[model samples]
Target: MPRRVLPLTDVQIRNAKPREKTYSLTDGHGLYIEIMPSGSKLWRMKFPQRGRGDNRLSFGAYPVVTLQEAREKRLATQRLLLQGIDPGRYRDDKKRLAAEKGSNTFEKVAREWHGNKVPTWSERTATNTLRRLELDIFPEIGRLPIHEVRHRDLIDALRKIESRGAHEVAHRIMAVCKQIFSYGIQIGLLERNIAADMKDVLKTVRPSHFAAIDTDELPDFLAALRRNESRMLKPTLICLRLMMLIFVRTSELIETPWSEIDLEKGEWVIPWQRMKRGKLTVNPDTTNHHVCLSRQALALLRELHAITGGGTYLFPNQRDHKKPLSNNAILKSLERMGYKGKMTGHGFRALAMTTIKERLGYRHEVIDRQLAHAPPDKLSSAYDRAQYLAERKVMMQAWADYLDSL
Candidate 1:
């Protein structure tokens, strides 16, 4: 026989007194109110589980939760149980989701993602990435809950940037936001990457290559460089000539630490960390890029060492010896020499590649290897770093001699 417990009334609950021990007043269907010895009242529920003893759940303290509200909670919990869901677990998940939503703001999650990526990025890249977010993005949707940020919200923010005529900047910011959204998904704070499909949404920006001059123009360019040398700083002049000799990227050249050089061996082994695509600071399988120094290059380095020998960087900033020269310094120097739109520091790479192939008759692969570019065949990307080492040494010296001949 089942026992029938009458439904509780507000008056009955108000008149109830606490006993020496806790006592429960049932309103049936597993819902009841417990009167504690301390005179505090709480609502509780008991439900049956198939292979286990009955489980109980708390509906919070009474007076805060009225009888009607407690009944509503009881009905909701009963529905979960009927669907084979555990009410306690459901409630816990609900609480966890609410806490996550409150804590994972877009800015907070983006900053966390940025921190996790700092190790893989150059110091300049890391700084510029965060600065772009702070200046352009955070002010727009920084405080929004990450999960709640929709596609339209992201487009609206990116559109605002595009409207400013900074199409490249807008594109870069959108890419960064997409990465952040993916990170949010990885961390369980977001469900979808809303910014994934926005690749062509912004204005179409024509790809621009670094300005380079044809090999025949090298003679005139050299003449201009010589005429402008008196107006250029001594270090800047040396940097320009070294750039033409080595033909490395401006960042790689300007940021060179003296320790990376081996004047005794006539080699400069740039560690993988300094390489643009370095995935790790210390990698065993991926050897560093070796620049074979020519007689011309060695002489210039000796001249540079006389000035900056005691410093850390080969091209230390004029005002701050401890810091490297600005990446823009070479560009500014070239612009001053009247080569603003025609040539760039990066243009030297193109110039060297073409002249060596045409004049010195070196294979493209050998020249590309010296240029520190991956092999064209995807499978051969991990080829030995010393592949064609002897040929590359000969090619580098020949290229330097060709440049001096001009």
Candidate 2:
């Protein structure tokens, strides 16, 4: 017959070293503590497995797990065994469920959604979307299970953006929420997107109108911009001039990279991803076509290059050489030049429309293509590459020369 073991006191266990020590206790329970070569001590409960010979269940480490705590844990496992359950299997199942639950959290789904959509967005757009999520969504429903998110919870979260008087941003946040929820549905994390049904709760507001400079005053404004002396002020003036000359969106100009320009070809190839219309509509041939550069525009780029070319962006932020100039940098310069409320960054688009229509006598199609406006005809639009290379070259030079004459 095997010798029975006895329970050891805390004092006896503490003195026990590098050897297998066993104690047969009074309650038909056997206590065994093992001291490893590293001098670390472990407590184990050795009990009979009804069908099997014998098994050991590790209670815990010594010191960190007190004697009382280890005994309590041992008793709990014993009770489970008495109820015909395997404590080890039960613990493993609980851990597996917890991991699955964590993976289904709203934040996890949102991150996955962001990862999928980021490749389709420009660097700037991706940055802005993540920033918005970090600021707004992450704090509220980020940890909640995706399936449990309600419309009211999403509305309350978006209301924070609305409260800031950023109605447009609120709308954008709603779109982001919808996208994330939709992704959850597609991935089988949620049965349906609650954001899809919450659109009616949001208030509709008119788009804010931009205040543009009167067409007659553009000459004086152009002249003033050319003569401005502030080191920081000149590049923005040139950027504004280019925006007006090409009628491309202000965002395109601000984020312009040096690699996108081809001086020999006299074209600035705006990638489809960077264009206002997303990448799907971009024609490979059209997207790579150059915006014709005039002598004056070329001269301006040369001069600006002398100052900012050492960096990656054409117009880098003064404080951080890595980042492009702030989106409002040009608008702010216009305000400093006393054009506040009279002209905005977007005002340049209107100015170009008016100039091409009233002053230059260009066709609407030519003007719209130069502006990169979406084509009106579906079939012709598919075929139309907006071949404005020759016309734009002439128009840009004339516009620059006109600015010089101002």
Candidate 3:
């Protein structure tokens, strides 16, 4: 049998004085307030653990937690006990989950993901990726607990980017966020990737190729480029000419370190790490991309070297020579040359591929190897293992001679 303890009144609680030793005043059941010698009152509960024994839980302090709130909490804890749950353990688990959610914010997880992937990415790639997230995605939902973030929240964030007419950027940011969430799930910070299904909801970005001029447009394009040379920086002018001659990817051209170029040997050995899909080697013999610089290209390099020879990048940024030129530098220069919408920095690759194949009379395989096109089938894969060094060296010189003739 249990003794009948009367529920305490607010009046009695307020008037209660602390004794020499800490003491409790019960409000029936197991709910009570402990008064310390320092006159601080704390709410607490005592409950049986069925098979284990009794355990106590501190609800909170007096006035702040209040009498009514403590009763509600005691009832909740007792309810859990009746259902064979440990109130203290349940409370601890909830608190732990809350703390974890606070620490596992979207921004925190995203930064962690970025840090982990930075080693594998180039300096330019790493910088742009983090800057994109910081400017776009982080501003919207970066503070939200990743686990609490739903697909709708993500859609809302992406909608803001779409509102700005950055459809392609929106698509890219969504992909980055998907990878971020996937990484969260991988490390047990989240149970699911909230951003997985968001792609279908975003605006459909139509596939578009890099804008390039046909072979016949080369003369007019060259004339415009020469005319714009006075308005452009000397390095930019030289870079454009080299791009025309080499026709490598814009990134490959702009990010070229001087060490990669051997002017005397007339070769530019772009390391495998610098190339796109570089993991898939061009041939079994080597992974480094070897470019045979034609005499015209070498002359241009020597001329540019006299000006920017001491610096790292051949096409160092005009404002900051310590770094490579901005990715937009070439495109903006092309735009200045009055070829906006008609030609892109990337367009040179297409123009060269077309001209070299049609005009040079080179076989498909030979030109394709020069272009570093990924192997399509196992047969081509085997073909990829062939460096075609001797033929490629001759072909590259001919290509340059042909461009000079143009």
Candidate 4:
């Protein structure tokens, strides 16, 4: 007959001491506290192997892997043993499966790929890319294994996006799919990029131009913007004026932090971190954009500073001082001024680009560089940054004075 074993209590386990030789205090049915000469106590379980000799598994050290938890592990191991499985091997297999699941899921790989790819991407591009991937890609196939993704699965998702009048978004999604699959191949997770075969899988899209005010309408529009009483926030009105003077994208204007400006230097330096141009993240120092401040622009900044100087942002959110002004604030303000369809917030760039070239007679390269049009390559782009600083500063003052003259 087999000997009956008793379970170990906490007191018994705690009272255990070490000696020169290692020894064990058995709890019951294979669970014991093994006391080492170094005064370390480890909880170990000894069980019979499947139709073979004895096998042992470490539950963990005492106190850290507590008495109750150790017993639970022992019970779980015994359950596996009853099924004629090796408890250690079963646990190891489970661990392997978990690790594989962690590294092989589409979300995991996609995030990893994004991290690798965005070192050079502008803050906007980086943010938008991740946001789109999370919203569109992650929901559909992010949980599945990368290898399990099929062309049809992607086509279906793209089709749904296209159905909602987002043909361009669908194309971008397909491109992301191809890139991710290619990355997976490099990492040995996929054999071939199924996304490579996804051309003509989405609807063709036409380029849409942002509605801009005609160059001839500047006087009326500026007058309308200055007197617009519908906009509740004074800062919103000032922001619209600044956008016209600086002619930056609405995003660049609204998101401007006070640190980026230099009222004394007569310059507002839009850090590479703020601009929509990509590759600034990789080499941030090379892309800081310079906007020469005219006296009128400076006057506006000084006025705005008095109101918002306490906060980090030039146009801090009314409710939350930490955040910048909302993107919609400018658009809605335009809408309120009855320029909703006639002139969007982005229209300022087009207006400035055209007028700076035709009316101001500045070089196209100078105007384009000031407008922050991204160059063809990152190296060329970085080289192009502030190349015409002296010329641009002159152009900036002229443009501002011209606005004042009108």
Winning model by TM-score: 3
Off by over 4 Å in 4: 1-103, 118-126, 272-287, 373-391
TM-score of decoy 4: 0.66
TM-score of 1: 0.75
lDDT, each prediction: 0.87, 0.74, 0.84, 0.83
Clashing residue pairs for model 4: 120-279
lDDT of 4 by residue, 1-406 (tens): 9777787889988888889999998878799989999989999989887567887888889889999999899889888878877887888988896677556988889999999978666666789989998888889988889888888888887788889998889888888888889998898777889889876777777788999987889888988876785655778878888888888888788888888888788678877666665344443444677777777889999999999987899999888999989888888888888888888878998999988888888888888888888766777676665377778777888999999898
Clashing residue pair totals per candidate (backbone < 3 A): 0, 7, 0, 1
Better structure of 1 and 3 per TM-score: 3
lDDT of 4 at 25: 84
Comparing 3 and 4 on lDDT, the stronger one: 3
Q: 44-136, model 2: which lDDT tens digit per residue?
A: 777766677677777678878777777788788889889998766766787786677666888888888888887767676789998988888
Model 3 agreement with the true structure over 59-130: per-residue lDDT tens digits: 989889988999999989878978888888898999997899788999999999999988777666789899
Error of 2 at 126 (Å): 2.4
Candidate 1 per-residue lDDT over residues 169-238, each given as its tens digit? 9999999999999999998887899899887789998899899988899999899999999998888899
Superposed on all Cα atoms, model 3 deviates from the true structure by an RMSD in Å of: 4.9
The residue pairs in collision within model 1 are: none
> Best by lDDT, which number?
1
Model 2 regions more than 4 Å off: 1-99, 209-211, 223-228, 259-278, 281-286, 309-312, 376-387, 404-406
